[model samples]
Target: MMRSIDYGNLMHRAMRGLIIEVLRQVEEGGLPGEHHFFITFDTRHPDAALADWLKQRYPEEMTVVMQHWFDNLHVDDEGFAVTLNFGDQPEPLYIPFDAIRTFVDPSVEFGLRFEAPADDDEDEEEDDDGGDDDPAPSSDRQDAEIVRLDRWRK
Candidate 1:
């Protein structure tokens, strides 16, 4: 017998498209009209490359601020890359199109979550605030770390 399609995965896939589009908007126009994005993804994912020092320090989740402080923003068919200063250190990151897991904009209460590709056998670390509602620091950084999540959508 024929099997039914999984709508859950289908929806997740659709959200993936929307997430990329939103990101492209920022990539193109530089976060127009008070629209900033909170994007979280796997730091150790194959296509992502952080300075060895940052990987040692964070080991897992990193969240980036796409407002006020980001540079070298470029996007292509493969994915996007950008430069942001973390603390006093500058880092470059390459993110694949399929690696983005969550996108949120607190300014408008808009959000999207998806099943991004996973890293292999890496122990996930919780955010420093113990999963509480602590605001991420806003600095004059040109780049921010991509935020990491404590839990998976699956």
Candidate 2:
């Protein structure tokens, strides 16, 4: 005999909930020693909000560095908000938990992948030096690009 079951959507929602919980821990207790996160998400996600100028600047995908001077970090049932210094200006951004596609910290070898909406275009990863790899700046941030985490996919 064969079994018939329906669980795709259920599993998807459950996994999403788990991802949010982990983020909540980081927001509440703070990131573990030397363990910061490289979070990647769709800039166009409905719940994602950024300065209009920022959207034009990043256009498609953006990665935020969550260490050092980040502040006002908050997370809730639907999304999260945080403030970071961009150049000489402080910028605030709100991104829904659902928009987060990849969360990882290479320093600790810990990572998580979540369902992510499709990106309409493909672009090169942006280095931390305000553009691609540059020879002049040595303080540029370099992090792996996070994308939709599809763990169960074959």
After superposing candidate 1, which stretches have Cα over 4 Å from the reference? 115-126, 129-154
Q: How many backbone clashes does candidate 1 have?
A: 8
TM-score of each: 0.69, 0.65
Model 2 agreement with the true structure over 1-154: per-residue lDDT tens digits: 6476435445446655766776688788877789777776657667799999988876655777787767788888888899888897899999876566566666656565443223223354345423322232122112223343232123
- Candidate 2: stretches off by over 4 Å: 1-11, 115-154
CA lDDT, candidate 2, residue 53: 91
**lDDT computed for candidate 1:** 0.60
Model 1 agreement with the true structure over 1-154: per-residue lDDT tens digits: 7499656566655666666687678787778778777776656557777788767765555666677788888887667888887886667887765555567776666766544323222355446522222232222111112233324322
What TM-score does candidate 2 reach?
0.65
* Candidate 1 weakest lDDT stretch, 10 residues: 136-145
